[model samples]
Target: MTNDMKLNKLLLTLSVGALSFIQACRSPESDEKLKSTIQAALETTPGIEVNVEEGNVTLDGQIGSDSLKQNIEDKTKMAGGENIKSIHNNIVVNLPEPEDAREKYHEIIGGAVDSTLTRDVNLVLADFPTITAQVKEGIIVATGNLEKSKIDTLKKRLEHIKPKGIDMKGVISR
Candidate 1:
């Protein structure tokens, strides 16, 4: 083929490929598809409701904390992809009534505690890499190796959170 013919053919092929790419990158044509996609993303979480209208997404649910509610909104956005224009996170954080927290003693934990409490305990110990804490029925059990002074500090801090009791028996003081 002539050089001119070859260049024209290349340009035509390039134009077709670019058009195909654009079509694939386009968002879902219907709101229902977008809603279903978001629903699948948030399936693990219960009490959540998803609604979509003209690219606007409304999320309603009851969650334990603000962080969790924000997480749901973010996950919905990721699932909806370009199809979601806006998100209305109307998730209510159902805070429980204040507890008496009259924890007198530490109880032996046979297994993992509630996920939220475990997460909170982990966050509290983020600075102390050597320490790990667990809770069972409001009792906290800490095990790790650290300086004696730091252990004292940790005990005070853990007490601030008011876990029924702090068990550092497994903790080794240096």
Candidate 2:
């Protein structure tokens, strides 16, 4: 083959190789951008983790309620766009009470216990009616117009439906 023909063939091969490299590079950059967007959207949600692999996104986390989980999934779908072939949501709803119930007593009780406002033993004791209907994973210190019978009853109920780890103290009904 002539030297000029051989030179032309070499240049063509190099051009094709470079084009392939650029295309390959573009894919990963796009995937990274998608991953970043997904992470940003999920930042406010607690107990959730986001990961992207080969253009597929997976969301794993614990949501406070079932409705919140659905909201997260819908938002994720909107963010994925055309490049995202599939999404796997493994979100867990940590609602303590049954769905059909008018009120989630456990969640309400847990929230109150977890709140800084109810951390005071005196405040919790004075608010018996407000707190009695709730269930929490914490120590209960009773004080004030609470009767021993009432206190014992509350303690028994708490023990019966004890949440993972909780301790009761000074549960004396006044």
Candidate 3:
């Protein structure tokens, strides 16, 4: 080979080797940046934890819902950028089961409904418009838009039932 041809071949080989080295090398600073990026993105959402090392990220802890989990994962992958080689998602879906408020609190408010029914169906319908009462774990929750006068009467009626507490916060007076 001519001198110029050999010099060109040597330069080509060096360039390929440098490219390989650059591709293989991953800096701790980049890992830290990735982690911080994920943290900053997910900081407002509680129970999400991120750990990154050498372009690999591991997500731990819990998320409230499936949609929320997906949202977080999408944001994480986006934030991790092209440097992320793999993600090990170990996120748990932690959600509290909805309480069967009616079943649990039926006995507490059942008598009131029964008493109202016994007096007169029209009375029940007139006195309580779309009224719903449920008791869960000793707490009573009543929902409906009630007049102030009806609210006073309902309170008096519920007083005899003796619940742990009555939550009428959802009830708006008209």
Candidate 4:
């Protein structure tokens, strides 16, 4: 091939290679920024734990109340930028359940929901309750109706049991 033709091909290949490199390099900085923002949000909210994997931020741990959980998410979104792939709100608020404490808290919460009192609260616990109670990796799921005043009372009552985890999916009174 002519030298000029060879030179042109080499430049084109180099340009493509450089473009690919730049695109690949972009995500790490974005990921780091996301991580820092999530970390800050977690720090602001008591009992919130955040883990970032492949640009997805998973929040785990118990906040005192559901309002706190929502607030954490809002703040994280504001700080982390719109590029964040997912924000897993796996946070659980502590609550009571009946069963072996070692078993998953979700099971216990499930049992509680099945009990007579659950209907009175006007709440339906989903098959896999959205409320997950976790502490140091252990987990329990609690889902039911919750009046604002009753939530504090329920939390206090559950604290006495002290299971490995608690998930309180208490719906606010309509």
Judging by TM-score against the true structure, name the best candidate.
3
* Residue-wise C-alpha lDDT for candidate 3, range 1-174, written one tens digit per residue: 999999999999999999989877788898898899989987766667899988899999875445556667887888877978988888996643223322322432343333232222233335587677765555567788888878878765655344456777877888
Question: Would you list the rank order by TM-score, best first?
Answer: 3, 1, 2, 4
lDDT of 4 by residue, 38-64 (tens): 787566455667766656878888744
What ordering of candidates by lDDT runs from best to worst? 1, 3, 2, 4
Whole-model lDDT, candidate 3?
A: 0.67
So what's the TM-score on candidate 2? 0.41
- 173: Cα error in model 3, Å: 27
- C-alpha positional error of residue 89 in candidate 1 after TM-score superposition, expressed in Å: 0.4
lDDT of each: 0.73, 0.57, 0.67, 0.56
In the predicted model 2, the residue pairs found to clash are 146-173, 146-174, 147-173
List, residue by residue over 1-174, the lDDT tens digit for candidate 2: 999999999999999999977754547677788888877776655567877776788889775555567767777777777757678988886644323221332342234333322223333345366333222344443333466567666555544433343344533346
Candidate 1 structure quality by residue, lDDT tens digits, 1-174: 999999999999999999988754545567788888999998877779998877889999776655567778888988988877789999997743223212211121112224445666777799899998778766789998999889888888777665656788989998
Top candidate, metric lDDT: 1
Clashes of 3: 1
Count of backbone collisions in candidate 2? 3
Model 1 Cα displacement at 131 (Å)? 14
Error of 4 at 167 (Å): 33
* 2 versus 3: better TM-score goes to: 3
